[model samples]
Target chain A: MSIFVDGNTTIVLQGATGSEGSFWAQHMIEMGARVVAAVTPGKEGQKLHGVPVFHSVRRAHAQHAAKAAMLFVPPRFARDAVLEALDAGIPRVVTIADGIPLHDQIQIRAAARAEGAQVVGGNTSGVISPGKSMVGMFPYWIERVYRPGSIGVMTRSGSLTNEVTAWVVDAGFGVSTLVGVGGDLVPGSRFAEFLPAFETDPETQAVVIVGELGGTMEEEVAEAIRDGVFTKPVVAFLGGRTAPSGKRMGHAGAIATGSSGTVAGKVKELEGAGALVADRPCRVGELLARVVQ
Target chain B: MRLLEYQGKAVFKEAGIMVPAARVVRASENQALRDEACAAARELMSAAGIGRQAEQDPTGSSGGETAWFAPGVMVKAQVTSGGRGKAGLIVRAESPEDAGQAAVAIVEREPSVRVILLEQMVDSACELYLSISTDAGSARHLILASAVGGVEIETLAEQNPTAIQRVSVDPFMGLQPYQTRGLGYDLGFSGELVKRFAQVTSSLYQVFRANDTELAEINPLFVTQDGSLIAGDSKLIIDDNSLNRQPQFEVTREQYGTDTEYEAALEGIPYVQFDGDISLMCAGAGLTTTVYDLVQFEGGTVANYLEFGGPNYRKARRAMELCLKNRSSVILIVTFGTIARADVMAEGIVGAIAELKPDRPIVTCIRGTNEEAATETLADAGIEPLLDTEEAVRRAVAIAKGEQV
Candidate 1:
């Protein structure tokens, strides 16, 4: 009933031999996430922490029938890795690796869109439908606290989500899904894409959206909120209150390129568009605590 | 990264696109800047086929012939950011003397003004947004055209997106003339207009793809004064990830916002320079936010939230000093994370404070995580660890108000 990765979804890990891929593969397995297959070119016939590894996504899928994928490959190889997933007819993919070239990113996004595949992040932390199943590497401490419930969680910063989730868990509400939709500017998925799934999911009654400065993704989501895509109560927080103007926090692509993408402006826009926006992350618990009931 | 106008022009030129007759003269410290301005003026006049007679003073009126040079002379400031026109960076000069004076004033008064783009301001018959980007989840090369042009293109599209017809070319095929022509028709074009739009779109796409562009925006894609299609105001954002393929284009550019830039500071940390601030420290966003949270909860106002990250007290002290430029009522520090160095972190803070003593209450919280045995470290420094972020904040606020923790 949760969004993104759920208990039954068989998953494959791309770039499984890489440091990040290996680290998360181990973490996800430890957190009780189903680690069905690992895909790396030369790591074929080997294993990552006892999970079988294959040379390509197709081979991995051939053996395990994996329906979802998480990419930890480098930017240059992201397109090929994603195309491999798409080629294998895997409908959903979550790419966590950063440093993708912008042109190749557009191509990857386009291919995913044309094929109707849900590509989570080209430079993203990946998604987690808590309690049901987990797909990517979110903090283990936070995961234990967050129970499955009606709240769908989304944040730009992967670490920030864990921090917010810690408070949410302590406050005694479970997360239906907690996703770090990749704070990188050129992400594979937008809030607009995640909305339909959140909208249809029966277990979800509310959403806590955490956004950062840079890009119109927040405004796009604000527009969707205005359009009545979700009828549930939504409490949102836009981080980077003290983030200097014009400097990107990290992920070279996430600079405030346009007028509307700044943090204060986003807060104004979200509140204007009917979102009960928290001024800072500190007030998130206070804001959400009131709304969910 | 904000590219200077000349650098942006260079990026455009590298893609083999036609720009105004111009060259950036680095004369911030030289009088030769005036001569460079004159040379730039002559180039503009020559390009427009307006030949001046020998020995004629460049500023002299050409028989007052209103149809003098192409359209008129444009003197623009070369800056790295967009909206220079809004900043009055670009101006139209009446004569060579005016252009030179403008350049000198701009150069000396503002070091940021490296050069001026002196050229014939051509009239636009129309404008279009001929760009290559990803739209609708597809890597697309789109030729967006409307009869109307200029900065209001977005508004025009929103009001009537249908009026602004698009020609989506495949990533491999790019923007073909036939595909562009189809878009020209959708935008109500026919006859010579169709060929003109198609040609410009095709050229722009070639430039866009070859240059490894993340975005190539020719806002108000010009229909030149000469009845030819050209790019007006090119805005290109190069993707850093692709720079490896085009090593020649590799330029070290990072956005260093003027916010809290104290030479010793790095660009992307949760750092802010506050006038009245505590030597506050915390890890992660949620824990860091507790400074503002617990303070306000206890009838206190925190100056701002600054995260030192991990459990390192060295970073915490630097952050605290940075926040304590004017100093807060008291210094309340909090550290609780998986990688706890509560002892070393507390010592660093105490060490920093001992060297820079001022009249203020210093409430420290070095107690959390792996600091139970580290009590000896705090005790050795004649300091005690506050139990939690709330107690420290409450105590700091109380000390500020002349009360007790």
Candidate 2:
């Protein structure tokens, strides 16, 4: 069983009339995800890839029962779109937009908590449950990377996530659910937030995390591991060790702002908590191979 | 973009926050402009009623200009990099000539110096620190305040942790008056001082929100002898993503120079030059850092780093052109499309290659969203794409190292 989405998950695609939105909507459909409806305000009646489209989430919810919503809206409108998804009782939302204002993300995070909903990203690549359902825009065309395995993958970096998943696949394992929590400073979910679900998923024998410099999310994950909140074997690959101290690297959250965001600080904390940490992405599969055994 | 001290103070003034009276003395390589800047500093000091007395008696044996500083005015060099006070860039002048001389010395030392500010020095009982910045861990705006100021907050944080009082403002509720009062109390303020502190805190938040500021800091929020709070110094960093809403802040990028990353930023590209041989371009910060690490691990040197400029093909093409212009030993473009489409990115790279055609080996790892079409497009330009991320890096490193891939 997958953690976030699966074969039974009926998803609604927001901003579905846009190029990226419609394209991903079609791709999701091809991956066997039930794309029940699409939403674009001006083109409500227009159908994309044979899926019905509505102007509002409320209108779409009234006609079709959807368990999840994937927002392909622009950054400026991401906050309202996530709030709309939450208000419409779509329990899970995955936003693909990047560069949302920090204030907007803060409000979105608060609203999500109040509604008891999970919003994956404002800058994320979306989530994928291999061989089950892909709500995100993963490179499903190369189906070799994800073969429905027992390792759960959660990462802040999108591109690096691809590299790690490729390693996992090559090591004779597959992902139960790979969630991109985004590389932004204020992502909806932290590394610790997903560990519980990974622990509870019987299909997930181990969890692999791809973290980077900046933020204390990795340190929080270490706390979770030490406290026994996550019982599964965990292997982590922390990037940006070679990056200059003051430079932002690539992610807005990937800079060493204080003593906590340093790569050494994160690695020391995770290793201190008994989580095997890999210095490089190529080392992750090797470390996990030993840990999961 | 980070604004200079004078520019930050201008923003603070616009937000109704009180700042010291100051004037900017613009500098240049030309001696005439340099002289004019010094003259401008002299005029500023004269207007503040400090430099006139020193002009009359340069020796100051007759108790002129208080022997050291020009009674009230301070010459502050404007530079983006910090520690100016410790760097001896900031100078206190006792005369208009001294002020001008200070400006000239600073301008001569730092070519990046565009302007020097002469500010009316505030008489203060004590210095306080305050800043409003987003805390990623808590996912909220953090209001950091300390009674101790005029020194680096990092040093203060290291020495006395409890002296710093932090209050996380709920984005929904914002910074309420009661909460500010509690913080003010924690900082040893009460009654009217508490109300004033709360007002300043609220106004600073307004400035931060209205300007789409990533960070707004008043390092030395001075408490004057008369119990009034004045913003002694400030630093403001605008979120580049919010530039659409903040049109006035557009000029902040113009202040950037050739020595800095401004050239790439102007083209809407994220490029950071490194001392290496291989040119690397990719999407996402995580991937960029990982690629850099991987190249290093494989014993390859990266001359430059470029990120695909958002989802726009034009910006991506510009980013490619910039990397191609770097003249590195080999160029590697490893991109994984998620929010961005592989086809669009391929179009960008192909367009750049057809136009620029740097006589160097280029390797690209194209994945996600219409991968076949993207690969075909790259192949049409006589460039073969690597499907695997690891193999692509290995190939690029191998080529950079002058080995067969």
Candidate 3:
């Protein structure tokens, strides 16, 4: 009943020979993700945790019929890898590299749109449907944080989501699917883009969004809710309420500029759109209780 | 990284864009370097045929027309930040000596300005704005053109939105010829001027792509009296992530917001210093900012925002040392690791404490993978880890305000 990835989804691992790719590939396998193939140029025939390796995504797709790809490629090569996956007709892709050039990201997003597929992130931790499959770098074994339940979570930050979701679990709730949309100026997908899936998933009773300043993705979420595109109880916690303008706080995309992309602006918009906005991370659990009930 | 005007002009020149004849004079305390710079300025003015006695009319008039004088040279401070005109960092001088004096005055007034650019002023008939910038919302590169230039584009957009014409370019299909021509016509250009405008914009687009520039701007793309186009000012901001591919532009520590920020960049850690008493070290950017908001909500200000996790998790010790160097009375470490192991972060914090024992109160809320080990490590180091972020933030804020635990 969860969205995006599940136990039946066969995944291909890009950059599987790299240290990060190999490590996360094993973790994904342990969490029930079907890592059927790996792709690393010039490393064909090698096996990463018993997954068959190929030189290209197309070759991997042909041999294993992988439905999704998890790319651990570096920022410089992120565009080509994602395009390669899209070219191979892979319906879903997840990129884990940060610092991908803005121009490259634009191209990747265009390609994904043209292909009618979904791409997760260039700086994301990845996605996880707890107890079904894990496709990202999430430590899903943490039962206190990631027990399978009815709450669907989408986030822009990796570590912050862990903390907020812990509060969600503490409040007697568990996640159906958690999607990390990535914290970049141009994410492969936006926050509102995933709302329809959560809305249709019967297992998902409500959605929790962990958003930040910078980018109009949060505003887009508000638009979706206002337009009745997503008719579910939604609780959001937006960071960087006091961040000074023109100062990039940690994330490249997390900054306030001019009058737009401010926390207050996003909060007002989301609240006006009939969604409850939490003042703090711990308050997310309480807000969800109010809205979901 | 935002390049100085002179640097951006150099990039524009490399792209074959027409720019005014210019010379650079760097401010130096050394007398010899100052003398050399002054001499270079004089040579530049002389080369431009200014102050040549033979060219001046004896009557100082052309029949019944007004008296004609040599065009003044523009003495501009080479600074990265904008608003130089309002700050009086940009001035016009009639002679090389005046230009040198202007440069000296600018350097003396704005200590941050180290270099000055001396350029022959163009006989401009019209000033227009043209730029190629990345539009994050649309996930496309945008070409913004306006007939109203020499002013802030944002203000202009607010005042008269139609004054600016925006064209979004697909990354796969870059600045097409027809798109440029369409923009030129939309900006009120006709005949050969539109072609020339397209040429200049095409060259600017080349510069934008070649340098991996997030923004390549000409605030006043000057139309000379003879109808020739020239870039009156250049602003190029290279993407920081693509700096490795752009070897021509070297980033210095001074380019960063602060010395500590530069140091943090070297360690792959994101740090932003603030004016408060509570220092924060978190695992991610979003968390660090949220914690900052929580602290401010609880009536406390953060001294700095530093996040070390993901690939930077191993640098926790160094990040902690950075927090220690700040003027905060207490340090708050709030981290809930997913991909970043909590034990690794705890070990780094413990190591940093062991190496440099400080007298400030440190509150921690560490969780995630191998939490028991992280908890045990902090306990062995005489630090009890709090599990709740709000409780930790409140405690840190109270401790910073000198309240009881």
Candidate 4:
């Protein structure tokens, strides 16, 4: 019933011999995600949290039948790793590097489209399907935040996801899945791209979006809602409301260029499209309650 | 990083694109340097066959210097931001001495402008716009051209959308010849003019790809009276992420923001200072901005926005030290760490506080990924962290207002 990953989904860990990669690979395994194989160029046959290791994604995919690839590669190599996963025919890929070049992201998106697959991030924490399984950096053991339920969550921010999703759980609801699309100028996939899956999932009765003021992704989500591509009730909390124009508010993509990509612009568009827009993160849970009801 | 006019022209020249003959006059208090700049301007004018009559021989039959000093030279202030022509930062000078005077006046008017570009003004039959930029919507490099040039492309798009013709270039295949030819024809060029236009467009695309440029723009691509196209102005912005590979672009502190911002940039932390009373630091960009909003929503203005998370999660102490330098009444740190461990961030925060204790009140809402250990670390340091972000922001705002927490 989860959107992207579940307990049955066999995952391959790229860059699995690295420190962050190894740590998260163990964490994913601990959370019941089937980590079948690990990929590191030189360190083949090494085991990561009892998972078999291979040098190439194709070799790992051939042996383990991995459906997904989780990348812990650095920014410079992120594009190649994602492309390798896609080339190996892995249906889902998630990259956790935050500093991938914009051009690299463009190539990654094109490759993902051509392969008919989904790549989650270059700056993301990863995706999590609560209770059933998870393939990201989320601490799923925290019941106060990540209890299994029917609401779907898609975000462009990492830390904000934890805070906002905690509010969702606090509102007497839980999440079916949470996807971090990453906060970059060009994400491998966008918020609207995941909406169709959320809409069709019987467990996902409502969706919560943690968007920011930059790029047209939030506006695209609004367009999707207006076009009836997604029919489920949605609640969104947009960040950077008080950010000044022309100043890059931390994220490379999180800048208001000219008049577009402003918080007011996103708010108006989302609200006009019949999605409940929460001004505060705390209000997300309350709005979700109202929308789902 | 946005390159100065002279720098961009140098890059264009490297790419084999045609540009107007130019000389740079750097503003300085040194008298000798000032005289040299004036001399450089005079030399440029003489080279362009336009100079003072006094500098020429009394007899008209001297050298190859032309008698006509008609179109004159252009004195442009070499600032990164645009609207120089409308802001009176660009001036036309009929003589070399006039060009020097114009440069002096421009530098005087805008004291921050340290460089002036003096170029031979081209006589144009018409102007066209051309650029290669990364388009976020299509996730590709876009080639945009228009016959109607240089009145701000955004304004032109709103008023006359069809005037701007766009073609998305595939990242792998690059900009094709047929695409540029089609663009040239669409802009109403024909015969040899179309060929030349296509060449310039293709060369500009090469410049874009070679420079790791986010935007390579030629506003007012002047079609000279003699049917030659020359780039009147160059706007090249190199991708910040690609700076490691682009060693040619030396990012100076002056090219960007204030001292604090530059310092943060060096440490790979994204920080933007504001004119407010609260110094806000968070774990992620989205969270940092949301904290800014909440602080403002609670009627408190933020003095800065600094995020030290993701790859920068371990640099919490460094981030805290930077935030401590801000001239703010209160400091607010909020993070719901996921990939960034809360305990590690707390240790860094505690370490920073112990090393450089400030008098300002500090409020935090550090949670997620070893929250208990993080809370314990903060408590051991005599800093109690709040659980809710809104409550922490309210407390910080109240503390800034000199009210009870």
lDDT string, candidate 4, B183-249, tens digits: 8888888998898888888888988988788789999888765466777898998877778878998
Give the DockQ (C-alpha) for candidate 2: 0.59
lDDT of 2 by residue, A1-293 (tens): 87889889999999978776777788788888988999988888888898899989989988998999999898999999999989999999998788897778878888887887888987787889877788888876566566788999889987678777778887878788998898887898777888888888889999998999988888999999999999888899988887776667767788875464898999999999999998877778888889775
Native contact fraction per model: 0.23, 0.63, 0.72, 0.74
The residue-by-residue lDDT of candidate 4 on A1-293, one tens digit each, is 89999999999999878787787788888888988899998878888787888989999999999889999898889999998999999999999887887788888988888788999987888899988777778888888889999999999888888889999999999999999999887889999999999988999999999999888999999999999999999899999887887677877788886678898999999999999999999999998888775
| lDDT of all predictions | 0.64, 0.79, 0.84, 0.84
DockQ for all candidate structures vs. native: 0.29, 0.59, 0.71, 0.72
Q: Which RMSD does model 3 reach against the true structure?
A: 4.6
- Find the candidate with the highest TM-score and give its number: 4
Q: Model 4 misses residue A122 by how many Å?
A: 0.8
Output the number of the DockQ-best candidate: 4
C-alpha TM-scores of all predictions: 0.75, 0.91, 0.91, 0.93
- In the range A161-214, model 3's lDDT, one tens digit per residue, is 988898899899999999999988788998998999998999999999999998
lDDT per residue (tens digit) for residues B62-103 in model 2: 212222223556788777777888887898776666776777
**What's candidate 1's DockQ score?**
0.29
Instruction: Give per-residue CA lDDT, model 1, range B199-257, as digits (tens).
Output: 65666676677767666667666665444554556666666567677665534322222
Candidate 3 ranges beyond 4 A from true positions: B30-44, B49-70, B91-109
